[model samples]
Target: MNAEPVRPPAEAPTTELERADDGAAEPDATEQETAAPEPAQQELAAREQAAREQAAEPSERETAEPVPPEPSKTAEASPAESVPTQNLPRDPARASDVLVHRALPLIRSGELGLAEATLDRAWELDPRNPQAMAGYAALYVAAKDGDRALKWAKKAVRRRSRRPQYHVLYGDALQLQGDVTGARKAWTRALSLDPGNREAKARLADTSAQAAK
Candidate 1:
């Protein structure tokens, strides 16, 4: 019994008690390193999810269907269009006659400017018309521009030699320019064209009286 002296069992290893009063246990270096990467992994996963969502979304131009262009309002003709087919083969002679008729009232009312403007428009409508040229001659006669009157009157006579009015207007211009003989000849021709022409008779009488004077 003395040789086998019993030795007390080795005291059980005692674990150190963690106190609540002290701070929580600090992680080891290896644990801290591993934990630091967890936040980065989560952030990387979040970024990847956001990228996936962005890639799935359609762009504005791609999402919207192509819209057709609206038809042009100006290009399309209206159903009730007013086409001037009546004047398609424009009769300058007829147009000038109508204009002269319209302008006569204005001339008689002493609206010389307006009459002249209307006659000018008539000339533009029918430049070669005898009536338009005669109108211009009459306007110049009224304005006391004897030279211009004679010029236009001669043109009218040349264009329409058979017109009694054209001969009469030529006689008037000649009278204004003091060409008594020429006026008498023109008025005589007018009377020959129309025997009952009062204006030609009066003009002839006046020319005869002037020659006697």
Candidate 2:
């Protein structure tokens, strides 16, 4: 026997070596499987960092003081409250004068409804008040209601015949009604009561010039 040439026990079968290599490769695969979660972990960390950043920022309400609301533009003062101390009348007799003074601008500005309401209130405050009656007469003249203007004008003169302004108002109402003679007499009476009455003087001049024409 040739001493049994044992070639290293036939060098273990090639298939057995291949099997060992395969076994070694299994551990590398397991390591690769474990490392696969690193990308997912990085994504999760990125999301957590973004959440922290957002939480660190301040909100508008938390960063600044709250602003107060502005006052309303349409807020109005009460009639009594709106009147200044100087505008308030000293007595009941002058109450209608105060009201008329306040209403004139409103009437001129085409706020006739408001002026009427104010004059009505003045009348309620002082019934048969000369100034209130005169105010109504003036308002009716502005509205082109000649009958009502004449009626209120007569009432104003009846209430206070001595007041030159009342006679002037009556004259204006009479002039609106085409009563030229009546207007002239009323205006003449106003000038007699108040010699320096510029309005009465101007009206008399106008009436006399018209009569001459």
Candidate 3:
């Protein structure tokens, strides 16, 4: 029968000071002063000098960097981003239509000046748009500016020649302006464009009778 040999683990390495600390006390101060060489003292002085240089470097750097000024409350509150503009849809919803709808709220609130300004901007954005001219024409009529109403109505008709409503508006403007013959002609044109146009038919008959009389 054979038995395997058991080996203890190897011991960790230890410094000379640590080995001495196990049981032996350090040398007395008088003994150290007599035994310690000048070279050791020079090394100790150099290590202290290096530590002092490291500590002084950080303080010198802190002094070199100037303190930043405190920020004003107004400066912090100033907006860094711009306000977004709300734009109209580009599809079948025309700019003129959007302007008209937007102006309605102002009109309802009796903000006629703002309503007119909105309509004016709409017309400027789309000068050839029938709806824009129609809105302006209606506004002029409501404001009792017959001359501007007639001008805008005629422009609306000229821009959308095939629209019966445009012709009807022109006829109404002419009627209001005392041009009975011209009104009858405009209404007749509107009726010819749309045979079932009730407004044009009624207006045409009324104007014709008035002219005959």
* Structural similarity to truth (TM-score) of each candidate: 0.55, 0.55, 0.49
Give me candidate 3's TM-score against the actual structure.
0.49
Q: For model 2, what is the error of residue 53's alpha carbon versus the real structure, in angstroms, after optimal superposition? A: 49
Cand. 1 TM to true fold = 0.55
Better of 2 and 3 by TM-score: 2
In candidate 2, which residue ranges exceed 4 Å CA deviation?
1-97
Error of 3 at 57 (Å): 62
Per-residue CA lDDT of model 2 for 1-213, tens digit only, reads 559665654465568778888777445777887766788798998999999998999978898998999998767765544443345676766776687778778778877777887887777778867778888998998898889999999998998899998899889899899998999899999999999999999999988898789
Clashes of each: 0, 0, 0
Model 3 lDDT at residue 194: 98
Q: After superposition, how far is residue 130 of candidate 1 from its true place, in Å?
A: 0.8
Tell me the lDDT of model 3 at 12: 79
Compute the lDDT of residue 161 as modeled in candidate 3: 90
Report the C-alpha lDDT of model 1 over 37-69, residue by residue, as the tens digit: 677798998999999999899989998999999
Q: Mind giving the per-residue lDDT tens digits that candidate 3 earns over 64-152? A: 97879998766642221211114876643376678776765665676667668877766666666678787777667666677988999
The residue-level lDDT of candidate 3 at 100 comes to 71
